[model samples]
Target: MKRALVIGASQSLGSHLATRLASNGWQVVGTGRRPASEVPGSEGFAYERLDLSDPEEAHRFLEGAGSDAYDLVVHNAVTYGAIPGKPPALDELEAMFRVNALVPYRLLHGVLAAQPTDRFCSCVVVNSDSIYHATKQSAPYAATKAALRVLTTSLADTFRSAQVSVATLLLGPLPDPRKLADFQRVAERHDVPVEDVKRAFLRKANPFYVIDDLIGFDACYRSVEYLAGLGPAGNGMVCRLDGGSAGSLI
Candidate 1:
């Protein structure tokens, strides 16, 4: 069986992706902040605890996972928050950037530097269109993604000689129940009506939204599987999956 490493496989898209890959015959190893039992559908895969904010923990986790054991690595871990007034504190900024931007770089460097001559590896970084079109509330999140996009492109060039393919998938907002619940919680915390938050989301997301622009879990799984199947052909490719809106290769 082909070995695959999936970062941030505890919940949401990551959880779904891990489960799907396992069902399809990939020997999957997943990482998450929560315990293995807390993560749904983790029976057939290995789960490691990783808290990106804790440098020591993060380092040890990656070190143990190694760099070249897996044929594919999918980075889906993320930290999200929106500040209302002034920019986030230095510590907050650093942590978010470390998780979203730096971690992916580390994974790439490790994989490309150690891959065996006879094997090929593919690295996929889950990105957001917010990197291109940012809203007021998405500054920190968008900045991290924008930085990651450039890092991925640069690394793709650097690793081509090693027969390692690196790609960025710019994904649009998916209609997830947990995400909607988080939005509701945010609205409650700010003392704003839920409808207000919903409206803001609709307006900010309109430019990139399709008529029915909700991305489902299956679509995400298919996209990653397709990219992984590309083997040596998709080196340095950047693709966008914005549901019904627009899909392209950049």
Candidate 2:
């Protein structure tokens, strides 16, 4: 009766992971803006419709999502808020950091505080490194994720004794021929359908394409999963996925 909690389960990747977890025998608890309208098929699971952007709601949901404990916490929720529609007074960049970095940080801490056991809880988070160093436009979103990676590693180092684990899913590029031909190489390397990989991109249509690279996602998921399985001690680990052209973590 393992229970898993997933944040931002409305997206394709999040929804897919929810279904995948349910099929693998874990009872799933998820959150979204419109659980009733966008709720993923139960597949023998449950969901709550709430905006994780609301810190209080996010904290409350994480505090008691499952049977007083979560075997795994897959944090797939994020926000770029980098769109050009807002005014400077609105502090869009700050807001991006709040959701992309701050909220997730507080949620993790809250989760730890509420746990009955002193042990570290297993966690998986979604992020983008290519956005940080790879490109310049996504500075706000990229910096937050980059900082989060460091924090996750630090947690891994600080909490290994308790057996809690946290890992980041760092993504690369998608298989959009218009962008680059190397997408197919990456898709084949990870064994994920081309479409499944497309969700990583940020575009206005289809899977969208704001994300700079999707090719390295499979490798990212695998390496993070491996580190998480190793418990909190796996934190300081600098695992990376090079996609098709690279050999190993260098």
Global lDDT for candidate 1?
A: 0.79
lDDT of 2 by residue, 139-194 (tens): 55667777777666665555555546666666544332334444456678999776
What are the lDDT scores of the predictions, listed in order?
A: 0.79, 0.60
Once fitted onto the true fold, the runs of candidate 2 whose alpha carbons sit more than 4 angstroms away are 42-44, 82-90, 118-120, 131-134, 174-225, 242-250
Root-mean-square deviation (CA) per prediction? 4.0, 7.5
What is the TM-score (0 to 1) of candidate 2? Answer: 0.70
Model 2, position 87: C-alpha lDDT score = 36
Error of 1 at 68 (Å): 4.7
Residue 141, candidate 2: Cα error in Å is 1.7
Span of 10 residues, lowest total lDDT, candidate 1? 241-250
Local accuracy of candidate 1 as per-residue lDDT tens digits, 125-192: 88887776676678888999999988988888888888678888778887677768977998999999
Candidate 1 stretches with Cα past 4 Å from truth are 82-86, 182-204, 243-250
Residue 159 deviation, candidate 1, in Å?
0.8
Worst 10 residues of 2 by lDDT: 241-250
* lDDT, residue 200, candidate 2: 45
